[model samples]
Target: MSVQPDLFDRSLFRIRRHRALKAAKPGADFLLRAVAVDLEERLLLINRTFGTAVDLGGHTGLVTQAIVNAGKAGRVLRADLQVADPNLPLPDLVCDDALLPLGDQSVDLIVSALTLQFVNDLPGTLIQIRRALAPDGFFLATLPGAGTLTELRDSLTRAELEIRGGAAARVLPFADTRDLGSLLQRAGFALPVTDLDTITVRYDTMFALLNDLRAMGATSILKDRSRTPISRRVLFRAAELYAENHSDPDGRIRATFALVTLSGWAPHESQQKPLRPGSAKASLAEALGAKEQKL
Candidate 1:
């Protein structure tokens, strides 16, 4: 069998996360906090409380804190690339999302925020997550989806092509909602659902958007990334292109983040199941109370 090559550099991702943690400033975790609030609302909708919950790849423990504050979990343990921010809360396990050490059927709930987009083997990781979840357990995760950084991606690609007559993959490709839904089913989850949440953030300049990505530890870590440093000419040109193409009337640039949410439950007898083909008692025409029309 042929082996699949890794698409992302895990070591570089960890190093970048460490740097982001060290240089983090106020509002750097704005996305995480926002997602945490969203997750809390989701958990609130569920009536059952979790016996053991895990904040998988929780960088600053914001999701973990949210789980605690929701009062829906009996115990919450955090995990990440490292203890990115010890000042906030330490992780019970330091591990990559691809490599989970948690035992099979151990956790009742698992919530990951702002992670999984960088995982080299997302399908395998999802399978592992499925294995770790107890029967009828719940899983919720939010990550940057297909159209996360369209403005930056277009600007950078254009600028690089103009300067060097060529361009590499600067922005990592994000997961598609359809593909994620399929993956959830492939991983043996029941009642799988995936949806996109688009958020537009305005920045004074393109550089400001770049800095925000850096602060969020979301910079490129592609395996085939260029080793050469981005020159000033390219950076400035990219900024100019960005302003020209994606700017508000007030001259602020627009950056789009399409956050994708995936939610599912481990298979169990109690959970709802779809009816088998040809098993439905009522036909579509009968349900609609109209005769079926043939084309």
Candidate 2:
């Protein structure tokens, strides 16, 4: 099979994150914390405790701490690209998401927070994650989905087109729910599921939103992006377009974040499976007390 071209610059992604640490604001991790809360709630619903858990791409250990705080896992370890801050909690294993160092069936759980979208080979990474899980082990992750940052993408493309008569990909692509669920199944997970939650964050201006994106280490790092720097004229025009098009009644502009959550389990004989075709436990019409209509 042909290989897909690398879309993201992983090195640049790491560098941007390290730079964000130096100038990290108090609320720079707002998105991470939001995902963490939802993840924690999901964990609470699962009854059993994990013997060991690895928090993949868990920068600063916020999700790691959340996993611990949820009282779900007996022991938790963290992995990331680098240690951006000495004062903050560092990763237990510093490595790429696509190349996990853990052995086969070594971990009872793996949780990734807002990281997979940057990976160049997401399907391969999912397969690696599946291999890392113990039999019946759980895998949970949260990342920005296809609809995240619609306003910024629209504004930037329109502004660049209007100013320079052309546009480049200023936004990174994100996976949709259906594709991710299929990936999990392809990775050999027993019961793969994907869902999303959308939230809008309002900002006073586009510049402020851009600043926040930088602080969050979420700026575009597409490898094929144009080398020419964005001119101030184009930048200002983009901001104006953002304001004019996406602003709320109170004057603040809206930025949408669609957080997709993925969950699955390693295959095991004990797990539930779909029945064979034409082997029904009961007739659907009979269950509803209605006669079946022949096709």
Write candidate 1's Cα lDDT for 191-252 as tens digits: 99998899999999998988888998889999989999899999999999999999999999
Off by over 4 Å in 2: 288-295
Worst window of 10 by summed lDDT in candidate 2: 81-90
Q: Please list the Cα RMSD from the true structure of every candidate, rounded to 1 decimal place.
A: 2.0, 1.6
Residue by residue across 1-295, what tens digits does model 2's lDDT show?
9978999988898889888877778898888888888888999999899999998876767888889988999999887665445446556778878788989999999999998998999999999999999999999999889999999999999999999999999988888889998999999999899998998999999999999999988899999999999999999999999999999899999999998999999999999988899999899999999999999
- TM-score for predicted model 2 compared with the true structure: 0.95
